[model samples]
Target: MNAEGTSTAGATPATVTTIAGSDSGGGAGIQADLHAFAAHGVHGTSVVTALTAQNTRGVTKAEPAGTAMVAAQLDAVLADFDVRAVKTGMLADLDTLALVAEQARKGRLPNLVVDPVMVTTSGDSLFEGDPKQYLHAFADSPTVITPNVIEAQQLSGTVIRDLADARHAAETIARSGPRAVLVKGGHLGPRSTSDLLYVDGRAFTFAAEHVDTANTHGTGCTLAAAIAANLALGLDLVQAIDHAKRYLTRALKAAAGQRLGSGPGPVLHSVPVHSAPEFATDA
Candidate 1:
C-alpha cells in the first residue's frame, strides 16, 4: 500500500495525470502541478505539451511539443497507469488541443479538468490565433474546466468584467458541453478574489480575501492541479473545488515573503496540514 493507504500491487498509486507544458522556471505548468499533487498526497504524472523559457516576469520563448509526441506521451501513461483524473494546461497550438480533445472523446482518458490557459497573467499570449475554437472543442468533453476571467472572456466571446458576466460566460461555455465551469476571478478586480462554479444548473461562488504578493506566478495551474489531485483521491466535484480553493489560499499566504526569480517571483506552494481536512468522501 502507498502512503495514502491505497493498494498498489495490481493497481498503481491513485494517480492524477497532467497533460500540460513544462516551465523551466519551475513555477507554473507541469512543475507546479506535480508539486501540488505531491503536497496533496497523490501520485503525479505528466505529458509535456510545450516547453517555455519563462521567469516570473514573462514567457520569453515557447516551443510546443508535436501532436504525435503529445499523443504518445498520453498513451504511454494511460496504458501503464491508473490515471484517476487528468488536468491540462498550456497547449501551445490548436492542433495539440484538437489531438487532446479527440483522444478524450474516444474514451482514452478519465475525469478531465481543463484549464483553458490562453494568456499569462504577465500579458504573454500562450495560444495562437483562433485558439478558442480549439478550446471549445476540448471544453466539450471534459468533466470540469477552470478558466480565469480573461480566458473565459476569450472562450465565450463575452467580457467577464463582473460576477454577472462570469455567470453568463459560464452558462455559455456549459452550453459547449463541459459538466462544470469554474470561472476564476483572480483577474476580475483588485479587491475580493472570487471563483464561480457553475454546475447542475446552479452557480456556487467561492470567495477569498485577495492576498497581496508577487509570488503568484503559477496559481491557476496549481489550483486546477490541486482539484485534480482531490478528484484522484475520490472526492466529488464540489468537495474537490472546495479543498482546492482553500489549499490555494494557504499557498498564497505561505508565499507572501518568498522570492524565486528576479522577476515577479513564484508562490511557495506549501501549506500547513491543519488548514484542510485529511480527505473528503461522498458519503
Candidate 2:
C-alpha cells in the first residue's frame, strides 16, 4: 500500500475505504464502518453505493446511486489515497459489483473484505440480482468474505442448522475464491452465538456469550470494517479477524440496554474495546 510511511491525503498511509451504502440513521453501512475504522486509528473513506431512508425501526426506502456516479467516486478515491484495505457492504446491483471487481482485478484494492450485503438487519433485500453471481464476483484470493448463516446458505445452496451445516456452507463458499470464510451464526435460534472460521482447509470456532440485545443494527458492517482496519495495521488475516471479533463482542455488550432509536439500537462504538490501546507509548 504505497509504502507504510507514505503520505495519502496528507496523512500516514493507514487509510481504509468502505465501499457501501449510506444509512440516514447513521447506525450501519458507511457510518458504522467509518466508526469502526476510527476505533483502530485508521483513516476511513467511503464511496456510498446507495442511500436509504432508514432508522432503528426499519428501512422505508432505498435508492441506489447511478453506475457513472459510483465510478467517479471510486476513481477519485483511488487516485488520491493509498488505501491499504477496502470493505464492501451493500452494493446495489451487478453493475456496481462489476466496477468493484474490476478494481480488484487491476490490483488497486489490495486487502479486500467482502461482507456480501444482500439484506438489511430489518429483513429487506437490497440487491435485486442473482445473489450467487454477486457473491462470486468477490471470489478471489487476498480477499476475506464474511457471510452470515442465511447468506452462507444462499452462497452454498445448503440449509444451515448446526456447526456441521456451517462447515459445509463455509467450505462451499471457500470454493467461490476467498481464502478465508467466516460463517456467522448470529441468527441461530439457540442460546449462544458462535462463528465458524474456515481458513487453510481447517475450521475454527469463535463462540461468544450472546448479549441478547436488540441494539445490533450494524454488527456485521462493524466486524468487517474492524477487520479491514486491523489488516491496514499489518495484522494477518486470522489475527485481524480475531481482534475484530473481540471488538465487536465488547461493542455489542456495551450497547445492550441503551436505546439510540425507537427500534433496534446500534453498538456503542464510542466505548473503548481494547483493554490497552494499540498505539499508546510509555512516557
Candidate 3:
C-alpha cells in the first residue's frame, strides 16, 4: 500500500488523498485540499462525497452524493494509489460517515486526519444533525482530529472562552478515541490565536499571529491537508502539526492583500513558504 508516484525526472512523490465535498467556490473542500497537497509536493487524489454550491460569500446549497458514487470513488483511489495519508471533510450524512469509518477499520485509511467539518467560515452549517454523533464513529480510527473552537465546543460539550477552556475542551474531545486532538484557536478571541494539541495525556500550545484579513475561507481544510501532506513526507504527529501551522500562517498572510470575492477569500496555497513575489512562477 506504500506505492509512490513517479514524476518525469523519476522522483517519486508521496500520494495523499482527500475524501471531501467539492466546493464550487474554489476556496474550500476538495479544491483546497488538492491545492494544499500540491503545495507540499505530494500527489493528490479525491473522493467527492458531496457537492456544495458556494462562493466566498457563503454556501447556498449542498447535495450529498449517492452512496454508490462515493464508494466507487473510494474504491478507485484505494485500488490504484498507494496513498500515504488521508483527510476527511464534510461526510454529509450517516451513511457516508459510516462507509468512511468502515474503511478506516479495515486499515484502508492510513495517517487519517479527520477534520470534523460541520460549519463553514461564514456561519453556515455544512452537515445535518449533530456532528458529535457522526464523529463518534471515528473514535478509534483517525490519527488526529482537527476541530475549530466551535467544533471543539460541540464535541467536548463545553464553552471555550480562553486558553484554559481550550485546553479542557481538547482533552475532553481526545477522550473520544482520536490519537490526537487539535482545537484550533481561530475563533478564540480578537487577539492572536493559540491552538491546543492534546495527545497522550499531554497538551502543547502553538501560538500564531492573527493576520488581519477576512479572506480566511479555507483555513481548516488547508491546515488539515497540510498536516496530511507533512505526514506523507514522513514527519511524526507533532512535527506535522507544527509545520502545518507555519504553512497556514504564511498562506493567510500572503492572502491578505487579495480580493477574491465579496466575502472571505481563500488563503494562497501556491505561496507555501514565501511571499507572493518571492515564489511567483510564470507558468
Best by lDDT: 3
Q: The CA-based lDDT of model 3 is what? A: 0.85
lDDT of 3 by residue, 149-176 (tens): 9999999999999878988888888777
Stronger candidate by TM-score (2 vs 3): 3
Model 1 stretches astray by more than 4 angstroms: 1-12, 273-283
TM-score of each: 0.91, 0.91, 0.92
**Model 2 segments more than 4 A misplaced:** 1-13, 275-283
Task: State candidate 2's TM-score.
Answer: 0.91
lDDT of each: 0.82, 0.82, 0.85
Prediction 3 TM-score vs. true: 0.92
What is the C-alpha lDDT profile of model 2 across 42-150, one tens digit per residue? 8899899999899999888998897888889989998999898999999988999888888887898878998989987578988878889755687673478898888
Candidate closest to the true structure, highest TM-score: 3
CA lDDT, candidate 3, residue 208? 67
Candidate achieving higher lDDT, 2 or 3: 3
Q: Residue 202 deviation, candidate 1, in Å?
A: 0.4
